[model samples]
Target: MRLSIISTHKRIQKGDIGEFEKLFRNLYSPLCHYAFRFIKDMDSAEDIVQDLFYNYWKNREKLEITTSLKSYLYQAVRNKCIKTINHQQVKEKYNNVLRLQGQDYDDYSSSNIETEELNQIIESTIDELPDRCKEIFVLSRYEGMKYHEIAQRLSISVKTVEANMGKALKMFRLNLKGYYQISANQ
Candidate 1:
């Protein structure tokens, strides 16, 4: 039960650390980018790729590959990204149930707790953003301005505003991950 890259016939015996390392080095970045396309977060994408490689190495002797190594790696990354998304969705659903049940963990009213924590997370995440991106995001979201309006106010193109807003929302999603599990990501 040894793993082999079927197309290249590159046999991966348990002791072949050099070959394994080479494969990892060759594919890690590309796989991370591929995962990022699905998850929209670099950190989570890298984690997914790294975890895939780790598990691939851990059970090398017990695994079988029916496709090219690259294909297998890509498929694994895609599956893991989808799994992560699904897991996040499930957590979001659970959180929604808690919210609906009116479970209060502190002194604030239910609405106030969610709003305050949400605003805090948004502010902290925005604080970490680049200056221009932060300004654009604040204009579009906090100020309730449309993209075109924000762009005009900042004297930038609407496309620029859209790109910055995308970056900001991506950052927000990444930061909220494992912290808030808000229903919006659902």
Candidate 2:
């Protein structure tokens, strides 16, 4: 089966799909388990693994294998899981802030409006950040990358990554001060 997979990988590189199903079947469950450790949800883990495989097949020609195929798949799943977890953390943090302040959850319309406004403000602040600052911030916060990893990916020093992240947080805090005040008042 491993030889067959190597052969299929070769054919896949040539834009063929003869052994695609066999390959998918072989990798799917293990990759899902790998993702579930990071994501902590069965469905999301499956989705992450499926997307990883889909992307692998889609970009098969450009795919380089310094490591084994299993390693590459696991890395992709890990990255996706980190992204999912970060997004969920942001959402949960926002919700908890509202709930803790004893906001009027009975007023569904108002609650939705406040949530939308907060999200909009966050989006706008992120958009207004300087180009490199925004990129570093997204990689670190949204993608859950370490400062070292972000520095390596951007080919900059870790100190630069830390400085940029500090700037991003400062900008966000300044920009959202009014919203924070409003939330506090509520």
Candidate number with greatest lDDT: 2
lDDT of 1 by residue, 61-142 (tens): 7777778677788898998999999998987776777678765333235667678887898789989999999999888777
- Top of the candidates by TM-score: 1
How would you encode candidate 2's per-residue C-alpha lDDT over 16-53 as one tens digit per residue?
77666767888889888888889788999998888887
Q: Tell me which residue pairs clash in candidate 2.
A: none
- Taking all chains together, each candidate's TM-score versus the true structure is 0.51, 0.50
Q: Compared to the true structure, candidate 2 yields what TM-score? A: 0.50
lDDT of 1 at 33: 89
In model 1, pairs of residues that clash are none
Q: CA lDDT, every prediction?
A: 0.81, 0.84
